[model samples]
Target: MDRQFSDRVEAGRVLAAHLEHLKDRSDLLVLGLPRGGVPVAKEVASALGAPLDVLVVRKLGAPGQPELAIGAIASGGVQVLSRDLIEQLHVSASRLATEIEKQLKELDRRERQYRGDRPFPDLEGKTLLVIDDGLATGSTMEAAVRALRQHEPRAIIVAVPVAPSHVSSSLLSAADEFIAVERPQSFMAVGQFYRRFDQTSDEEVREILAAHTHSGE
Candidate 1:
């Protein structure tokens, strides 16, 4: 049977339930991928009594297929590329460079928008819970985990509401832990499992982070 969620909020609540065992840990912090992931991460942060923040990442799409991720770049100049996919698609060296440069501009724009002058928290020896609304290609989260590793975190746990079982297995080796509320056998898109799959806005992301910050202090 397919499991459907009413919305991201509901998905977050359900995801949080699975994370209850890790609650109240002194070194825990939640980092949400902006736009869609913040709301879901907010709930988990609340459940675990952990501080929340944003980790901006930009997908480097194939030249013509904007929806197809060739790779991704993260806030700290960290990038993860799919060499096999790039070669299969015949993406030229120059073309890949052009695409990466374009996405890096957008990545910087988002980093400033969400973070202002605030520095990323010290993540060394911290148990970081990185949340996203869900995974499709998993490139974005992979970039995030690799970037986060530079900070020497004790562990990186990638959590999501839904993902295909194969996609879930592919990302396992990248993180210390991976958790999802639903890993269905048959999956199309992440939105298909939700009743309300609206695009999350920048203002909403800001509000969620602001609210959590105020409450935490």
Candidate 2:
């Protein structure tokens, strides 16, 4: 049976339930990949009673196919690329460089926009829950996990609302643990499982973070 969520909120709640054992852990911190991930992470953070923050990641889309991610870059100058995909796609060196530069700029912009002058939260020795709406190719989420590893967190749990079974399994090695609300066999896209999978705006991301930040303070 295919599981469908009314929206990210409902999906997040379902995902949070699976994480019940980790509820209220002192060292737990939740980081959502904006802007879609923020809403889902907000619900998870609320359900778990953990502080919430954003982890900005930009997909390094392939040449001539901007929606297809050949790699991804995250905060702290961390990047993960699929060389096999790039080679197969025959992405030119100059074009690849251009894509990286563009995404890096966007990544920096998002980090500043969502966070303003606030410094990124310290995660040393903490157990981080990194949330996203879903995973299609899993490149972006993989980049996020690799980047967060540099901060030396005790563990990283990658959680999402929906993803292909294989895609979720592939990320298992990147993250300490992986959680997904649904892994349907017929999955073609993340939005297919949601009744309302709207694009999350920058304003929405800021508002969610502001609410969490103030509540944390």
C-alpha lDDT of all candidate models, in order:
0.87, 0.88
RMSD (CA, angstroms), candidate 1: 2.2
User: After superposing candidate 2, which stretches have Cα over 4 Å from the reference?
Assistant: 62-70, 81-96
- C-alpha lDDT of candidate 1 relative to the true structure: 0.87
True-structure Cα RMSD, model 2: 2.3
Q: Give candidates' CA RMSD values in order.
A: 2.2, 2.3
Q: Scored by Cα lDDT, where does model 2 land?
A: 0.88
Count steric clashes of candidate 1: 0
- Model 2 agreement with the true structure over 89-138: per-residue lDDT tens digits: 99989998999999889988998889888888888999999999998888
What TM-score do all the candidates reach, one by one?
A: 0.88, 0.88
Per-residue accuracy of model 1 over 12-40 as CA lDDT, tens digit each:
99999999977999999899998889999
